[model samples]
Target: MLIKVNDRVEIIAGEYRSRPAKGADKVVQGKVLKVIPSTGKVVVEGVNKMYKHVKPSQRNPQGGRLIREAPIQMSNVMYVCNACGQRSRLGVKQLDSGVKVRFCKKCNADQGEIAPARKPAS
Candidate 1:
């Protein structure tokens, strides 16, 4: 999956896209905390929050509800380009130095290097 941890993303589809209140951003955007490539799901910060009920245990003297982010389908999110500050698709390209990097498809901005430059063969 192109989406990686720490990458900022915006929800393109699903109920999370709905604004929580007036004057809020139209889309839900957050940093990717985790990615499950096998299941095609990603856990984004501040999105898809779910409450987990916990009983009193040794770990917690007082039990309470904990809010956590739930995984959402990878297809529902679009990468937000760090350079252009816009949501766009990501593409991988190899530079002349042989470094593979992720780039934004909309503004053609380089996000960051995915792999180190390869040494030329003797």
Candidate 2:
């Protein structure tokens, strides 16, 4: 719930665990990647993946195939600590600017800032 971008989260509530993630994955142990507050979904590096098929165009001319992606729910994962190399629950600390930062409960390291979201212009 307190996770941030670049926070290495662990699959505390998913089928994947104790293994290196596969698919378009990164943040194997760091960064939150993305957050979907409305749906409570969060994208972790190399976590969830789905395959897709595409029709071949002039580029392929063979009715080729393609794959797509989607983010998983944040509630399914927990932050991991750099010090202990283990998934840790988060602790909240309010800064002087009234900003809340995520701290690792196991090692007390800051999970860093959440990056600004990119959006398409209307």
Candidate 3:
């Protein structure tokens, strides 16, 4: 998956996309908290919130409804470009220096380096 943890993303589809209770802007965009490449899902911060009902336990003296983010399909989100402030697809490119980096497809802006330049094999 191209999307990485800490990357800002905007939900393009799914129930969370239209949740107004979180405010218009907040409902769409969030930082990626976890990436589940094996399952092709991602857990975004403040998105896909699910309430878990629990009984009081030693760990939690007063256990009740707890809100937590659930995993959403990765296809529902698009990477938010820091340079253009727009949601766009990402592409990987290797620079002349041999460093691999991600770029925004919309504005062609470099997001950041993914891998450092490596020395040529002797």
Per-residue lDDT for 12-108 in model 1, tens only? 9987676442333444789999999889999998887767799988998799987777798999999999989999889999998899999999999
lDDT of each: 0.86, 0.64, 0.89
**Please, what is the TM-score per model?**
0.81, 0.60, 0.82
lDDT of 3 by residue, 1-122 (tens): 78999999999998777663353235688999999989999999988887779899999889998887889999999999999999998999999999999999999999899889998999
Which pairs of residues collide in model 3? none
Tell me the spans in candidate 1 whose CA falls farther than 4 Å from its real position. Answer: 19-27, 55-58, 118-122
The local lDDT score (0 to 100) that residue 72 gets in candidate 2 is: 71
lDDT of 3 at 100: 95
Task: Compare the candidates by lDDT and give the number of the best one.
Answer: 3
